[model samples]
Target: MKKKSIVSMLVAFYLAFGVLFSSVSAKIQSEQAFDNKIVKRLKVNNIYNHIEALSKEPRVAGTEAEWKAVQYIKRQFDSYGYESELQPFTFIEYKAPTKVSVNVNGDTVAAAPFTYTPNGDVNGELDYIGLGTPDDIKGKDLTNKIALIKRGEITFGEKVINAANAGAKAVIIFNHLSGELNGTLGNVDNRFVPTIAMTKEQGDILVEKLNSGDVLSASITIAGSVIEEKTSHNVIAKKDVTHKQKDTNQVIVIGAHYDFVPTSPGANDDASGTAVTLELARVLAKVPTDTEIHFITFGAEELGLIGSNKYVDSLTDVEIDRIVGMFQLDMVGSKDAGELVMFTVDGEKNLVTDLSAAAGVRTGTPLTYGQEGRSDHVPFYYAGIPAALFIHSPTEPWYHTPEDSLDKISKEKLLETAKIVGSAAYQIARPDTPALERAKVAPKEVDYEKMTGGLK
Candidate 1:
């Protein structure tokens, strides 16, 4: 053949391939849109009831209450006729002090213990250590003495660690301003000495006394600081078509953390998220879908995404790659919380956000996405699966506090988010069939400007 004729033939072949690929892709999307009937099945009342029951008491990780909450969630999944199991993992658990006290020269001083600081009762001479920086203790002898450090220019955790490294018997941190210091070391650390917080006024008095050459004898006590190995669980429930042999290897995971902070009912922090997960499982269980849907409730999220990380780590590379998408629900039903926002680890939209946003624009609310790394969605995103976190932003004042109770939960908010996520999840997990196509299910251009955290 002539060179010109060969070039023309190659061009024609390329055009034909492009057309065939486009046709197949369009058909797949149409089938994935599936049926819309399940969207209406997500009721606010059902979600609210689950929240009321789960958040009736604090469900702190590794506590008996948390175990009960996990079991309760497992039972709910089983009731939906889905196969469910409890996945357990262990981690170092840290608890803050119940009581902290400081006595200086027979006078009781107001004090609070920083979380994760080792429990200690020590009597030693008081020595003023400015700022508690490494430089402040480089040459000074803080050994056998209680180091009085002023807060500022660094984290409380750093100050405690610095003092302990300097051989201080105990560390006392005073507020940089005027209030009582309340802080945490962020995580459990064995190097932390007994650390306590006090007001500026008391700190100033001690500093003045030391300057005047007065040797002060001090005693510090911290109680209830605990470091122990404890187990937490991830509850997994699977829903798929009855004919398991015809099932696709692809799976969709919807998850939420069931554990809360210490003393908090977590009605909004995560009971809201868990409730929404349960409701979604209930509604989607009977829906016909070729892909498997896994409903998971993780524990130890407050302790740094432990459960979700474990769940993802347990998966084989094939299983991880098989995950089509993951939707993580968190803090989705607070009356005081802001509008629904989706978040991805790398600040980019994936199948989860794209589908959820499409459903939001169609049915309940308009969902927008930004970057966030503080939820169960993070593990899936790290594992290279399409995942996004569904949450209400500008979090309520009750967040992580005891005030996060049922009264602060909004049924309207719950229903709105449930509707948005439910519709979105169904669109992806729904059986791909030509008959399930709908005009309302197409993906639209996301308004990046309207998204929170400025997109990146």
Candidate 2:
């Protein structure tokens, strides 16, 4: 054939090959069969009930509630006939005083501790530092005075550091918007002042009086403080039988964060994830797999993903490479939340996404795939293993709010998600079939018209 003819032929072949693969792929069976007998044991509502009980109180790191939560998880794993281990590590524990309030011109105002701030009490002149910064603080008299800083222009930690360096007695960083302020001051352990953050409204009350030349004598007290050497734990459970895998040296990890913020119950935030992981453990224990499947519940996820970071660091490069995929379930039980989405770091294609999405498609409840890495998946993804966080986003209004209770869980969503993920996992794990090489193939975008020969 002539050179031009040959080039045209190659293009035609690729198009034909692509067309054929797309047509045949839809008909592929995702799994031979799910032992629903095993899956039914994973009652979604039972998991929600568990969430209902555990989330009754906040499980902040290094606290009594956190320990209680850990015990509960241990108990569940024990009942399921799995080997459970609690890996302990220490992190800074901030204990805020029972009540944090501000007195602007002797009028008490509402406020809360800035996450990780040191504990202290101080009464001094209210100085509006206007977003306190090292440069803006020059020639400012902050010694023995309270600095009322705004949120923005830098991290809260930087603001605290700048104020402390300028000899400010206490730091009050208010929210940029009008509402209650809650969040951390960063993970670094060097904060020196008793700093508290409040809503923009609360801070503006003080700011308004200051502008009016009111004697802004303020009393700032942070019931919260930082503690060094505080400990946290990761609860891990192994199924009764070993998993079956193509590569004997490999493993698939499924995990979720069990901690919740002080005000939020976190039923969907992660109770859903934890419950599902446990249930899967129960079902998969008997079914068996070639590779190991480790089910874990993580603590201190609300604390800057500290627990996950510690867990990941505990493993070496060889261990990391052995991890074929990590599936992170965060907020998987909310029906009002949008359709299921799988997120990865840098939005690149990876193994976890490949498995979950493919399984979702095959299960007939396809999830919208996108890139995200805010949950426990980050650590594994950073280590170069394929990892993804499974979540229902836009969450509920109750998210991070006190209203996120057990009733918010959606069994249908949970069951669907579990079935898809479980079956997808089974397709790879079933001892019946030789483990297929993780075909790193991007999913073909559906083209019904072309596949049906332009049928309407």
Candidate 3:
């Protein structure tokens, strides 16, 4: 009787293993089918071309080019057969005075406005104000002098404002280092002056020569500006509107910044990410899913993450809590990119990173994990939601520059990212009959030595 019982148990175990393997195999087949469709849609579509065109022109917020870019995005969602919007909001617009020039001992040098600088033009003796704080200029006869302030010690805007209020005719805030310092007043405000920020090297040279009692002379032309009533909008496309579990307005948001810095086309900076988000919306909208997917492309991301902040702030506690996940896709189409990694704020792991890593394993794609969130995910994460930035480490050189055009995009990289993210999203969004469960095993740690193929 004992021998018969052992044989029955062994047979039962074998049957269970066989059935389990078969079920997992069938599920894998379905996932692969979904991957195939997603990849195809990414390529041979205007998605890449759309990126090229947008990158061709500057999409700096509040600029005509940005508005054109907005229309282009609206057209894309329309083409994808989804409802879109240009959700608008009011923000301070820091304006650069039309012309800002500096003169040192009769030789005129080039300069640009510190955004939001007050309007005034005056010539005064040059005085080096250490960082140009109100305290620094308190007793100095800087009544009509150009204060050559250093970069560090405070916000560049604060320094400019301090000097202007202290009765300084003009301000020259130079960089404390070698590279040119691009400064802004940050946002629209009435306090400003005809101020300019220069490279540390340039400032050092100017200050050194002046300390030798060489009477220095400087002049500035200030043209401060503000848009009395200006607004920018964010577009959102939704999927799986009526999720099964409505207890909380739980949602998973995938987004990328659609605005670029001035002069650069911003292709890889964001066009790549924006394009992919669009493709995901296209594919996922057709497939059935339980989780709500909010496909968004943000405006003014370059302007201090305003769009994303607004979106998160608008959410009530119940809504914010329901935001189970947030994924930010920025600059994902460059070649020679480093290992794909998920980054959080303090290098702490979160749900998005863990789930994404597991999905990579199931799909045979590899991803590196890290905690370095500096994108749209920050606002959400601070709200206590799971968030991450999907980016390849050590981004390409052309990032945020004119060189970030279509030619720089790597089709292979885009397709692979789409596949991995699509699968990962689907696993959570639309599981099979039994419903996809998180892998029981902890994610395997990345092995750089083996991945690099050899020692350097």
Compared with the true structure, what per-residue lDDT tens digits does model 2 show for residues 1-456?
Answer: 699999999999999999887665543522323434344555676666777778788777788888998999988888878879999988776555676777877777777787677767799887888888777888887888888999988988888888888888898889889778787777645556878878898888778888898767788776635456677899998653254224455567889998888877778888888888877777777776766678888888887788899999999777776666788889988877888888888887665666566566555677766777678889877877778888886676778887787777788888877776676556445554343333222122434332222211
Model 3: per-residue Cα lDDT over 16-55, one tens digit each: 9888777766655655675555555555255687687778
Please list the Cα RMSD from the true structure of every candidate, rounded to 1 decimal place: 9.0, 7.6, 7.5
TM-score of each: 0.71, 0.69, 0.72
Pick the winner on TM-score between candidates 1 and 2. 1
What would you estimate as the lDDT of candidate 1? 0.82
**lDDT per residue as tens, model 1, 1-456:** 699999999999999989877775554344234425766676788899999999888998999999999889989999989879989999987767787888999999888888778888999999898998888878987788898999888888888788877778898888879877788878777777888888899899999999999999999988887789999999999886544554555678899999998888999989999999999899888777766788999999998999999999999887886787788999999999898999999999876786677667666477788999899998888888888998998789999899999999999998888777777667555554211111122234434322211222
Question: What's the TM for model 1?
Answer: 0.71
Q: 170 in model 3: Cα distance from truth in Å? A: 2.7
Point out where model 3 deviates above 4 Å.
Answer: 1-58, 63-65, 75-81, 90-100, 103-115, 125-131, 134-151, 174-182, 197-218, 221-231, 242-248, 261-267, 335-339, 371-374, 401-408, 431-456
